[model samples]
Target: MTAAKKAQGPVLTTRALNRATLERQLLLRRHTMKPADAVAHLLGLQAQNVKPPYYALAARLDGFEPEEFSALMASRELVRIVTMRSTIHTHTADDALALRGLVQPARTRELNMFRKGLAGVDLDQLVVRAKELVEERPRTLKEIREALLERWPDADPQALGIAARCSLPLVQVTPRGLWRQSGQVSLTTLTHWLGRDDGQEAVPDETVLRYLAAFGPASVKDFQTWAGLTRMREVFERLRPGLLTFRDEHGVELFDLPDAPRPDADTPAPARLLPEFDNLLLSHADRTRVVPPEYKGRTWLGNFAWSVFLVDGFLAGVWKLAEDKESSTITFETFGKLTKAQRTELDAEAVRLLEGPLGTGLPYDIRYEKVVGA
Candidate 1:
C-alpha cells in the first residue's frame, strides 16, 4: 500500500477565514511593523482622504512617527496617486504602478460615467496637453483646467478637469501629501512623478501575487472586490501553480500564500482603533471577517466617509469621535456585550489613539456605552 499522504488541517470556516484576515491585517492587534511595511502587507493604504491611515499606523506600531511616512512619500519610496478604484490612495511606488496596470478596467468604467461631460473630446489630444501642463511644474486642477480652456474653451472647465482626473495618468504633486502639513492640491503625470514611462500592459498575475502576499487567505471575489476589477478568472488560474487555497464552509474558494501566517482562530486579539478607510476593513468582499454584521451599516454609511472602531480581532461594534474646543472625546458604542475589563481595555486604547496615534494633543473623554443605552 502507498504511504498515506500528509494531510493539511480541515478547511477553514468563514469565521476562520475572517480570523486569518484579521491577523494579517493587524486588526488582531496593533503591530510593531513600520508604516511602509504595513502598507505593503495590506497591499496599500486607502488614502483618498488623508490623516486616517497615519492614525491607523500609530495605533498599530510602537512609537510610529508621522515623519517616517512623510519621508517615504518625499523619497518616492511610496507615492500618493489616484489608482485603485480610480480613487486617491497612498501606495508603494511599485504597487501604484502595478495597480495602475491592474485597475484599467475599473478606471475605464469610471471614465464612462463622465462620457457625456467629455463628449467629442479627443482623449489622445488631452493626454499630450495634460502631460505638458505638468511635466516640470505641478499645477492645481483649476490651473490645469485654465490651461486646457485656451485650447478647448467650448468644454466646461469643471468637466475638463474631471475628465483629466479620470482619463489622464496624474498624481498629486508632493508637499501636498507631506506629513504634518497641509498644502494645495496639484497634479503631475505618473510618468513624470515616477521618472519612468507608464507601462499600460495588464499585469493580472503579478497583481494577484501581490494581493495574496498582503491580504491573502482571501477569495477571488475578495480580490476582485478589493481591486474593483472583474474578469480575473484567467489570472487566478495562471497563478495556481504558485498559490495554496482552500474552500470555506460555504464552499467559496479562498487563496493565500503558502507561507503566509495563519494564527489560531482564538488568538488573543487586543482592542484596536483603526483609521477610517484602513485597508484591512475594506480588503474583503465579505467583511464579516473583521467587522461584525450588526455594526456594518453604521460604520460603512454607504458613502466614502468612514468611522473608527474597536475590535478584538473580530468586529465588535462602531466607534465615533466628537470633539469640542476643550477636549476630543471618542465614544465606543458597542453592538455586543463587553465585560468590565473589556470596557477598561477599550477606553485605554481609545485614549492612546487620541493622545498618541492621532497626536491631537488634546485630552480625551473616552467611554463605552451600551448601544441602546443603560
Candidate 2:
C-alpha cells in the first residue's frame, strides 16, 4: 500500500528535497533565532544524550553559545523528555506537554509489549502511585522501578518499571540535561516541573503543519518514522488542500507548506558538523535526501550514532570530538574522498565550532583519521 502510494505523486528531483531539508532545518544558513525559539521551531532537538542538543544548535544557529542554550534548561524554559520515537528530546515546556499528549496513545501502546509483566497489576493505580513518587521529588528510573515492585511484588520488575515510564509524561530533571554537567537521569511529571496545567492536547492538525515546516517535502511514512506513530495518512489528506505536493525520485508523494523554499538542484550546501542522533538524519522515511543510498547504515556502529558531517548537504563523513585539560581535538572519519576545497571548508567549520560553542581555553587540533578514498 505504501509503495503504491509512492508511485502516485508528481515527479520532482531529490536535490530540491535536500535544499529544502537544510533550509527548513536552518542549515541553509545560520539564523539569529534564540535557542529557546529554535527548540520550538525544530519541534525539539533529538536528545538521546546531553550534548547533542547543544551541538545540533551550534550547527544551525549563528553565534550559538552552549551557555545560552544550557541556560534555558537551567531556567526551565526548555526541558528534556521522551517525546517522538520514545527518545529523549529537548523541548519547550509547552511543546513537551502538547507533543506528549499527541503521542500519548503510542506511548501507552508501548505497554502492550510488556503485558505479560503487567498482568494482574492495576495500571490506573500504578499511574497515580508513579506520579506521586516523582512529584515528591525527582526520582531515578531505578528508584521508580523498585517502588513499583514494592507494590506489585509478583509482577515482572522490568515490566512494572517500563509501565511507569509508558504511563507518564515524565521530564528528566535538571543537572541531568544541563551542559557541562553530569548527573543521572531523574524523572518527574511535566506539570510538576512547569507548575501549570498540561498544555492543549497534541492536535494532529498542528503537528502536521509543524512537521512540514521543519521536515517536509516529506511523505506520510517519513512523518510516522520521525514521530514514532503510524497510520497518519488521514491527517495528511485533510491538509492536502492547503499544502503543495511533489514526488521524490521514487515517486513518493511529499507535502510541504505552499510557500516553503524548494531551491534548485544546483545550490551549494555548505559543510556542517552535526551531533550524533541529530533529527535531520533520523526524521525521514526515505533518508536519501540527506544520506546517499550507498552509505546506508554507515552512520552507526554497535547501535551508536556517530556524530556525522554533511558535505554538499548529504552525510559525507562522521566526526568525533575529544577534549582534555590541555587541548581539544576534532577528528573526521570520512566516507569518501573530499576535494581540497571541501577539506578547507571542514577545517574552517571545525575551528569555528571549537572556538565558538566549544571553546575550552585549550589548544585545538583537527585530524583525518579515515578520510576514505583519500
Candidate 3:
C-alpha cells in the first residue's frame, strides 16, 4: 500500500505545506529585502490600515526601519491602491498600473452591482469625469461625492462615490500611507502619480507563475481566492507542463513552480507576528495549513481581523498594541498553551518588535495574559 501511494506521488502533510508557505512569505526567517522589492515580491502588502504594512515588514525583514518603507511611499515608488479582492493594497508603481487592468473585469462586476443606485448615471462618463477630478488634483471621497452629485443628484450619494471607486484606478496619495504620518485618503490616477503615460498590463499567465513563486503549492481555487478572479483552472491547465504536482493529505491536487522551495514537514519555524489581514492567512481557500481548525474565527471579531501571532508556523494567538503619549505596550494572548521554552522565545520576539519598526520614540514594554480574552 505504501509502495502504491509512492508510485502515485508524494502527499504533502499540513506541516510540510506550512513550512513552505512561511519560507515564501519571508516569515521563516527575517530577510534584508528592499522595501519596493519586497512589495513587488509579496505581490503587495495588505494595507487596509496604515501601520499593518509597516509592522508586517518589521516582522519579516532584518533590521527594518519604518522610514525605509515610508520613503518609498513618498517617492511614489510604492502606492496604496484598491486592487486585489477589491481591497486597498500597497503595490509597486508598476503593479498598481498593471494589476488595476488585470482585475478590471471584477471591478466592472462590482460597479454593476450598484446599478440600482446609479439608475441614470453613465459609467463611461463617470470614469472620464473622475479621472479629470483626481488628475487635476487629489480629491477626497467627500469631494468626489459632491462632484458626482452635481451631475446625478438623484443617484444614491454613497453609491455614486463607490461606483467611481469601482470604475477608476484611483490611488491613495502620500502622507496617508507614509509611516508615522496621518492624512485623509486623497486620490489620483496611477498615470498621474507615476508620471508615465503607458503602462504594461499584468499578463494573467505570467501572474500565475509569480503567484506560484510566492504562494504556491496552491490549487486553482486558492489562486482565485487570492486574486479575486475566476475561471483560472484553464490557465493552470495551460501551465501544467512547467509545474510540479502533489496531493494534499485530503487528496486535493496542488501545483507549484518546479524549483520553488518545499521544506520538509518538521522544519523549524520561529514565532512570527503578522499584521491584520496578512495574505498568509487569507490567500488560500482552505486555511487549515496555517490556521489550525480549532482556532477558526478566533483571529477575527465581527468583521475585524486582529494582528495575529504564530508559534511553530501555525496560528497560536492574537496580539494588540496600546499606546499613550508617554509609552507603548504590546500584549500577547495565545489561544493554546505553550512550553516554557516557547514562552521564552515569544517573549524575546515581542521585545524584538518593540525595538524594531515600532520604535514610536517612546518607552516600551510587553505583557502576556493567562488566556486569550483575559
- Ranking of predictions according to TM-score: 2, 3, 1
* Candidate 3 ranges beyond 4 A from true positions: 1-8, 370-374
lDDT digits (tens) for residues 1-374 of candidate 3: 34225225578899999988888988899999987888889999999999999888888888888897899899988999999899999998888898999998888888878889999888889888888999999999999999989999999988889888998889999899987789999998888988995779999999998998888788889999999999998898878777788888998888889899999889899988888999898999989989999898888888799999999999988888888899888888888778988778888887887766576668888887756352
Query: Candidate 2, 69: how far from true, in Å?
Result: 1.2
Per-model TM values vs. the true structure: 0.87, 0.96, 0.96
TM-score: the better of candidates 1 and 2 = 2
The local distance difference test score of each candidate is 0.74, 0.89, 0.87
Which residue pairs does candidate 1 place in steric collision? none
Q: Looking at model 1, which ten-residue stretch has the lowest summed lDDT?
A: 1-10
TM-score of 1: 0.87
Clashes of each: 0, 0, 0
Clashes of 2: 0
TM-score of 2: 0.96
Model 3 residue 69 CA deviation in Å: 0.7
Error of 3 at 315 (Å): 0.5
Runs in model 1 with CA error above 4 Å? 1-10, 156-158, 196-202, 302-304, 322-326, 369-374
Candidate 1 yields a Cα-based lDDT of 0.74
Consecutive 10-residue window with the lowest summed lDDT within model 3: 1-10
